[model samples]
Target: MLLTFAILLTTAVLLVSLSRRLGLGSVLGYLVGGALIGPAGLRLVTDVHDIAEFSELGVVMLLFLIGLEVRPRRLWVLRRAVFGLGSAQVAATGVAIAAILAAGGLAWPAATVLGAGLALSSTAIVLPMLAERDLLGAPAGRTAFAVLLFQDLAFVPLVAAVPLLAMGPSSHGLPTEVPWREVGLGCAVIAAILLGGRFLVRPVFRAIGGARTPEVFTALALLVVIGTATLASLAGLSTSLGAFLAGVLLSDSEYRHEIKSTIEPFEGLLLGLFFLSVGMAANLGLAVAEPGFFALALLGMIATKTLVAFLLARLAGQPDASALRVALSLCQGSEFSFVLFAAAVGVGALDQEAADRATLVIALSMAATPLLFAASERLVIPRLGRERPRVFDRIEDDGAPVIICGFGRVGQIVGRVLRMRGIAFTALEKDPAQLDVVRRFGEGVYYGDPTRHDLLRAAGAERARVLVVALDDMEEVLQVVDIARRNFPNLKLVVRARNRRHAYLLMDRGVGDLVRDTFHSSLRLSELVLRDLGIPEAEAGRAVALFRDYDERRLVESHAFYTDEKQLIQSNAQAAEELTELFAADQRRLESEAAARSRVGAGD
Candidate 1:
């Protein structure tokens, strides 16, 4: 088993790397790798069904992660798309396909099941396809996701109805009657998961989080998804649906990001395996034996679904290019259809021969989807005209002498001072909330992440005399520094450090003009306190200046041993002793000078 897995992984790595290098996506590579080592190819692993079942978990995890992003408010906002457009597309496509199949002399029940199954596009394929193109937040991508969400909701009922469609079942003995008990149990389980997600899940996560063991937290995250999925499966519901619900519930939780990060690798690996399994399960001989039939079926399915989806999207008020994109993105058959088809055959609603043929068509369509989208993107989308998606704001530069990366409090002050001096400067801020606030005050700051090289160049980093890294995020400051150093080698970096450690890190990174945000203010407060305690003004100023000089020197010295705790502590203690002695000596010198002046006055 291990040897077989080793072969699968090795094949995936090589093929995926080649595909990525060739500008084709990872999905294609996994599919081709699977085909190469599959039963129809080299026959490295024959039992594709087991692998398919296991890898289906990838789909569940994908949905869960997606759910984490789509919070309840966002989902509510998408209610129209999810219900109206999604339902219209599914119904219109299903009816059209079913009518065609019935006209071709297939039984109405089987045709209906096939059409419904096929009408539901592949969420597994479409989501990743859109993601690769960086379109997940675009109108077409959002619409596609909404439709897929509806399909997930529709899948359970579709599967449930399959048994009812089989009038006389000889194999596997599925009941013709609607199983009320099972249906009730499924609803009950869904409610339990929902309730648990609301009231129980967070508390459990909190307890586990309190333990401060990351592995255990990761394990619990997996357990939540798997456990919910298992319960849904036992209750005869869609496992992805259960996991999606769990994710949505936890979306607003503090732990969502951690859970997402933890589950993502497993999801990615298993998803690759799922694609591989699909490739392996493809019966290439059937396509080879009946070339004409195979080509006609494949073309017909994609064309019909694409047309129906495009029309529906248009009716839903989507623009021409976005509608076309939505259509092309989801023209393939779903992975869930495999389960539906298998159940249909088991219940005698569909023949094994028909199922095998449909399976091949679906697999091929999944493989072809990426190519189809790529072609449309390159050839068709440009012709239809492009509706530019919202991204980082375009920066307008007029040879600003200074480019401020962050437009928060520190950045705003810098901009204000520059404006007062009549110095031309450009400011960039990534935080939308901060940008909105700045705009209200009539500040001219372009919205963008300063860490991006493109945005930096657009903001006139090369022309600007100085690049200020005043971002609230310490990591972003470092990133800006690095980008400046690597890309614009001559650009000077004036960075603000949040603390001593941040200052030390900046020093290590070769940022010469570094200011600790609170250091000067703290020193001023200390000077004020000395004055309040009846110390002379000159003495107070001298004391503050003395401490400032000492600390600055100490900070630089400590940078060398910052990583070594013992050395840092020793240096800190030694600096404190030296500062005390210097203050004591200064006070004695003042007393001696006063005494000499008093004796001279007495002699006079």
Candidate 2:
């Protein structure tokens, strides 16, 4: 039976749109759509395995983007948790779960596989939720990252553990899928990737950096990720691990943001596909056959897992409320549980009957996670009855020289800098508690959603000469920009972009002074001047100002192309080839200017 690609494409798009409209995660949409057209459902999308293989490019892109940020220096900050907290969580959870299963009359091998499989929380689902909720700048975000970091590190051991556990006491005629040669080779290859990447990846990037074409860099980054994953697959290792390693390799590159920009669209599409595939693969008949038993199992798993996770996080010093939040967030099982269970059943480890039971529980738990997150934030947090830190959204304007949209770390820094310079500024913060702290120091920050058309006028948008988009939520930042630009078109709109996509979006909206939130541009300016020459500090300052102006001009000009995405991509191909040629010519001009300056300095 053959299916048209057009139908598959339409299903994917329809599922995604429906999910977003319903305020559900795209993951659910993809899975539901996949199930409908799957062999068991409509039977129209049986050849979806090929689609799965292609959609995996999204994961490769995801990892590549992560790698661009993995500098060795940053690891020092997380070294304590990454090794101590992370290791403890994986080891304790895996062994404890394994022991429980073994006591329940399961083979040690099968139990171990199940435990390791269950330990992983979904990385794909958590980050965006945190960022969207404005929790990324909080203590919980740091703790979440520490736990997620540990979970990512656990992948290697779990992959290795699966095979060993499957060979339990009874030689139950289970055909071993992992050949000795492949396992041994995979372990060796993992070592090679870690060791070789540190030395080789940086130099490779330097040679390519001057190329400056987004596509070439995107292609190269994807190759590294996919190639590593292919090797891991060949060696009987987890491909996701290979993808994660690809991210660690480029964790410190100059064009990191650009790399991120190239990967985002692909990641969104494939991640959606992966979710859809999960849905299509679910056995609805099994779910329906024993609804009561399945419901109990789902509750039991979610409850047990959430309790253990909460206790672990609390022991690590998070407050009880924060611990509970963490617990609810991770109660869900992930897509890979299917992969792990399939292997267990194929081998003589788990009986098909037991595997089906576990599969039903995993699916229900995943479906319940988003609901749990929403409930915790809306119901649980407010009920805890802890007083919020502060409220400052009611401050009156007094002809403040600057206006800030958010009172987060970056906004605070800007406000403090301006204050020291004897410049008055009015800030707006939606988080009442956060602004309460700023109020004590006589800082003025009003609370209101800037997206409201009237809120901009109330915030003195007409009088304020400068408007700063300091909000962490990219979507909210855009809304603020749109409102501010429309009402006060002459206002200076300085913005903090979450990443390249955010930056590009802002550029399209006529923002001339957009700064990468994660990247310290002022520091980068100094670093760039030092790299080019040890020019005097004052001279370096002037050059940076010139370069900043030039970059802003380029961003403004590029807005026309970016607004029309199709044209932007079409132009990217041609622009990529010419960048090297253009860069060389610019270098010659810079060199001549440097020489002329040298001659003048000598005369002086």
Candidate 3:
């Protein structure tokens, strides 16, 4: 086993590096590596079951990390997408695929199982791909995540339904009666796991955290993941489901980030291993025997799922480009298909021949996922998105005094303030939905990317008195700042900085009047907390003002060292010490003044 692992790791590193150079994803490399080393090729590792069991750990950790990132509040905000669009996509795709399979002369029960299984896309594959391309925060990525979240949640019931579906089985010797009592008990166990994880896991981690040892915290995190998975398995639920629940429970915890960082390496390595195992398990013999049939099935499944996904996304009101991207991304069969099919075969619901064929299609689809994303990028996105008109041809220069680049949260607030002050501004928003919303509110938000020089000019950037760069993305913010600096040099620029780093970069690029997006809000929150803790309102306000002034000064002082990590660290430490001393001196002076006033009142 150790020798096999050593060979696998070595092959994965080599192939993955080569794949990177070739611009193919690591998933493809892992798959190829697995195929080269598996029974289908050199047969270096024949006992796939052992490797599979070990690789399954990767999926568990992956789901756990995903859970940690997904806050309950965010989920609630995306409830419509998650429950509505997600549920609809799953049902529609499942039924569509099942009907197709039944038309091909498969049993309804088996077809239904396979159809639902194939409807679920490879979350493990799709998410990493989306994140790699920096689209996880985009509309398409969020929509995909919502749908995948629903699928993970739906897996439990789907597994349960398999046994019930197999009650009147044919070929394989299995139980013929549905176990209602066991099913009820399983549901009860799942509830118990959820309740216990919610109430139990946090306190356990909290207790371990007080130790302040990094290794201890890491151990405790793994323990929570493994323990929850074990409990779920015992309760007849998917282990990945338990891990996911545990993650969601810890999402809002202080230790969530730490836990994620610690477990990420393990998750990544294990996931790659799992993918490699998938490649190794490919039945080359079956493929060689029926090449045409296999090809047709693979293409058919991809087309079916992609069509279903695209239609569902469109029905849910996503734009053509986003819907197309979502469709292409999710058109593959998931890792869960293997589990479902294996279970189906164990229960005589599906035959061995059908299972092997389905598995082959799924594996091929998984391999095709990266290619699908590439196709979306190269072919779909550019051709289908909102056509770029001769930059801002729709905008009329109304002699607007100000030009706002973005119409998102920060931009909207800035627009509101400017409007309240009777200042005229032309807002350039890239998102059509945002443009429509602001237009409905009687604001002139144009639909165009402001980074384009012609669009900026059309938005009256040349005539505008001030150019407010209130875009959310730091890259866009920097781009707009550069364009304004070069083209509209006279326009006083008020740029929003995503963070201190962004502010430093903007400063380096010669932009003045920058607002750190959350800096003021954080100061205000701190002031409120100070006031709540019995400090006088005036005193609290003064402290906040002093702190803000000191921080701003520090920012300016440290701007020169931003390029050098070591210098930046030293400068930050020095600035922090100086601020602490300054605050302490101010506190002493305030106390002294209070004492003097009290003394004067006593004498009187």
Q: Which lDDT tens digits does candidate 3 get at residues 1-604?
A: 6898899899889988887666667788888888889999999888888898889889999899888877787789889999998898899999999999999999998999899898888888989888777677688999999999999988888888888777855567555676787688777867776787677877878788767787888888888888878888887788899899889888856556568778999999999999999999999789899999999999999998889899989988889988987898899998888888888888888898998999999998888888777766876688886342233338889999999889988999988998899989998898766777878988767888887788888888888899988887776677677667756888999999999988998887777699999999999999999999999999999999999988998899788778789998888888889989999999999999999999999999
Better of 2 and 3 by lDDT: 3
TM-score of each model, in listed order: 0.69, 0.64, 0.66
lDDT over C-alpha atoms for residue 459 of model 1: 85
Candidate 1, residue 371: Cα displacement in angstroms equals 0.7
Best-to-worst TM-score order? 1, 3, 2
Better of 2 and 3 by TM-score: 3
Per-residue lDDT of candidate 1, residues 1-604 (tens digit): 7988998899889998997676667888888889999999999988888998999999999989988877788889899999889888889999999999999999998899889888988888888878887687688999999999888889988888887887756477865467789789988999999999999999999899778888999999999999999999999788998999999999866566668878999999999999999889899999889999999999999999999999999998889999999999889999889889988999899999988888899988998888888888878888887844446788887898899989999999999999999998899998777898999989988988787888999888888899988999775676678678767988888999999998987887788899999999999999999999999999999999988998998888889889799988888889889999999998899889989999999999
lDDT of each: 0.88, 0.70, 0.85
Report lDDT (Cα) of residue 319, candidate 3. 95
lDDT for model 2: 0.70
Q: Rank the candidates by lDDT, best first.
A: 1, 3, 2
Model 3 worst lDDT run, 10 consecutive residues: 384-393
